[model samples]
Target: MKRILILIMALVGLTVMMSGCSSQETVDVTADKIILVGTQNDYPPFAYADENNELTGYDIEVVKEIDKRLDGYTFEFVATPWDSMFLALESNKIQAIADQVAKTTEREERYLFTDESYFAAETVIVVKSGRTDIQTIEDLEGKNVGALAGDSYTLLLEEHNTKVDNDIILKYSESGNPAEILQDVQNGRVDAYVNDPIMINEVIGKLGLDLEVVGQALVNDDMGIVFKKDTQGEELKGLIDPILKQLKEDGTLVELSKKWTGGEYIPE
Candidate 1:
């Protein structure tokens, strides 16, 4: 009886040891889902918080489709401040940024980009609707220009037209997003604000804001996803490429853009 009891105890210990080992070795690559963060809540059509406070918009839908492609992986949405979105990525607080981060030489130095451009837009000066006096890009030369500090647009405004020797001093107002910039412009707090043309149109249409695009879109740019400044860049590249390609091929991107933006912001 002693021998039999000892044998049973030994078998139970073996089973427990094997079970623990198996559990430890279980690699859950799929369960290790990627986190996509954004700060364009007020930039609408790209990203924004609806009345319900849910993050919903063009960029939100695009990232959701990207999530669908990675069957094993899931996505968690976090609303990050615009200025801190990249910082969040750098700190690994978020795995990726799905905001309407435009491609820029300065940004390229610190980040990797996905090939797919959800939309092509240009920078434009937004002013109150009746302001015909500020009719062109030239009109903005000496005027106080407003843009979010530390944003891609600010860099574009600073570096693009260096030919002019300090023609306009960008009055970096530290607004949270483009909409706030427009609100300041309308309220006469700022002379003018710069932002994506599509976004300006969307905000005007949605809120019926008395804002108009005063000049032609400047600084042509492709909107895309951004990843950390690391060799693991290809991880996001590999995951999103196949999915975005499929979406483009099936006209899904256009459809989604329309659904979110009320029009084909991603023009055919």
Candidate 2:
């Protein structure tokens, strides 16, 4: 009887151990169901806070639509500053970025971009409303040009400046305040700035600023979601690319662009 009781106790212990292991496995699977996305809430018509302080914009809506189409995974957005977004992604704090991120050769080396671009816009030179002297990028010679410190547009401007023998004085701003930047231009603190034409127009309209874009497009850039260059990122790109392509084909992408920009901004 003693031996039988001992055997029964051993079996009970084994069962408990197995049950604990099973519970741990279930918990791991549950954790895998949540996907965190990062975005800057300061970019208007792309990812900005509404009057009620809810995040809503073209990029936010696009990600929401993607979440609806994909199954078995839930998305949670982490409002991160633009400058630190890539760092957060690289550290695995966020799975992807849904900001109006443009794909550039330098970024492509460090990150994986979505196969299908969700939006496109022309890069233009923005100056004070009455400024006719600085019309083209070439016209920025020896003038102070404002650019976000770590933005792709800044990189492009810097590259152009270097090509032109550093003719333009590059003024870097950490603050992502369009009003302040435009004010600087209006007050002669910065001679000009470079950004997407759509964004320039949006900011001017929203703030009642006296800024205007002058010159033909310097470059046309396609914007897409960005992910860290890793196995998980590759897998996510594979899953998202097909859905994005379908959305573009079915006119949903164009509709969203119109909803945000009041017209289709997708490249032809």
Candidate 3:
């Protein structure tokens, strides 16, 4: 009888040790966990610095909301230039990007995009006020056009130029400055510029620039958070996708779009 009692006590102690080990492992995994999100601070109404120099914008707020819903995970924003944003992501400096990144075929092959899109935009041509002569892609022939280097707008212009037998003078801007591009158009340096219509309107209003959007929207794009194509990225996407769908269904995404763009830009 004494031997039986000793074996039972030994089993109880072994079970307690195993339980302690499992609890410690869980705690170690969750402790100090954080998600690094990248964004461009210059992109207003989407992601930008406010008067207090703190990062606050539509994208910034949306990420904050996600962080709140996710337990044991924190999101830290890393402001970067648009040109270098992808480089930073590829290097694992950031876990994801919340900038208004459009999902394109070429980019899809390299990165994993979230299943839910946070915003949508239409590309438009911007010219100096009173320049109604140039209104469409056909009018850009034999004219100087400017666009940010490595952007979809630049790709569209290049494709159009080729279709027209290279009649357009493409001025690729590497500075990533919307104001500089607008100034070039105002000074007659470039005949026109191309970018997202929502962004163009916000920049013109915020800076009080004398520019007007002309021509119909050239392309429609949906924007989503971007992640690296890897195991870690896949895990993060799995965690956020369901939450994003819930937000969309509950009308939170539409509310954010209206607050930032002054209209319901979220697609049905």
Candidate 4:
């Protein structure tokens, strides 16, 4: 009887040990995660610091909604300069960025962009008022084209130049000040500048500059969140893709777009 009782106690101990190991394994897989999201503080209505000194915008709120839906991941937004966001992401200092990042060949080579894009921006050639002669990119041969250096518009023109023998002078501004670039167009420093219609309207309307889009979209880019091209990036994308689709279906993204951008900016 004593030996039997001792054997039973030993079996119970073995069972408890096995149960503890199983629980630990479960915790390891389903443990809470803290994801660091990089955002810009100046891209108004998208990701900006408000007058109340709080970081709030369309992209900001979108990430927040994603966090609220996800089970274990907690997003901590780190607002930094536009350029610094990429530096931090490359260094692994941040896990993701929500600053209206668009997928380009250069960026896609180094980073991972989500399959679902939440926003769209169309780039077109903006010429001076009453300039109907300059319509498309082909018409801009022997003309100076102004765009922000290293941006999508510049990339578009660069690719176009490579494909054709045309001499489209690409004048780029490193400062990324749309006002200054647009002013250069008005002042005749450039024959035309490439920009989004929304931005062109905003700047030209405010500054009262006489500029107009060619009414032809040169590049329509669907913007998505960006991540490091690694296993972590892949897994995070897998997690986000489904939730993003749900947001679109449930009209949450539309509401957010309306709240911030004042229009339907989400891609159909």
Compare the candidates by TM-score and give the number of the best one.
2
Listed per candidate, the RMSD to the true structure in angstroms reads: 3.0, 4.0, 5.7, 6.8
From the highest TM-score down, the ranking of the candidates is 2, 3, 1, 4
| Residue 149 CA displacement from its true place in model 4, Å | 3.0
Per-residue CA lDDT of model 2 for 57-126, tens digit only, reads 9999999999899887778888888878999999999999998888899899889999799999778888
Please report how far candidate 2 places residue 210 from its true position, in Å. Answer: 1.2
Cα lDDT for residue 76, candidate 2: 85
Error of 3 at 118 (Å): 1.2
Question: Is 2 or 4 the stronger prediction by TM-score?
Answer: 2
- When 3 and 4 are scored with lDDT, the better candidate is 3
Clashes of 2: 0
Residue range 1-268, candidate 1, lDDT tens digits: 9999999999999999999888877853336545555556666867788999988888888888878777766777788878788889898888788888888777888888888777766777788878887866667777888867677778766764587764666776665667767777878877888887778888777667888887667677778888887766668777787787788889888898778655665633
Q: Clash pairs of candidate 3? A: none
TM-score per candidate: 0.84, 0.86, 0.86, 0.76
**Among all windows of ten consecutive residues in candidate 1, which has the lowest summed lDDT?**
27-36
Displacement of residue 62 (Cα, Å) in model 1 is: 0.6
Score candidate 2 by lDDT.
Answer: 0.85
Residue-by-residue lDDT tens digits, candidate 3, 4-112: 9999999999999999999999877756478899998887888888898888888898898888888878999998888888999999999999988888888899999
Which model is ahead, 1 or 3, in terms of TM-score?
3
| TM value for model 1 | 0.84
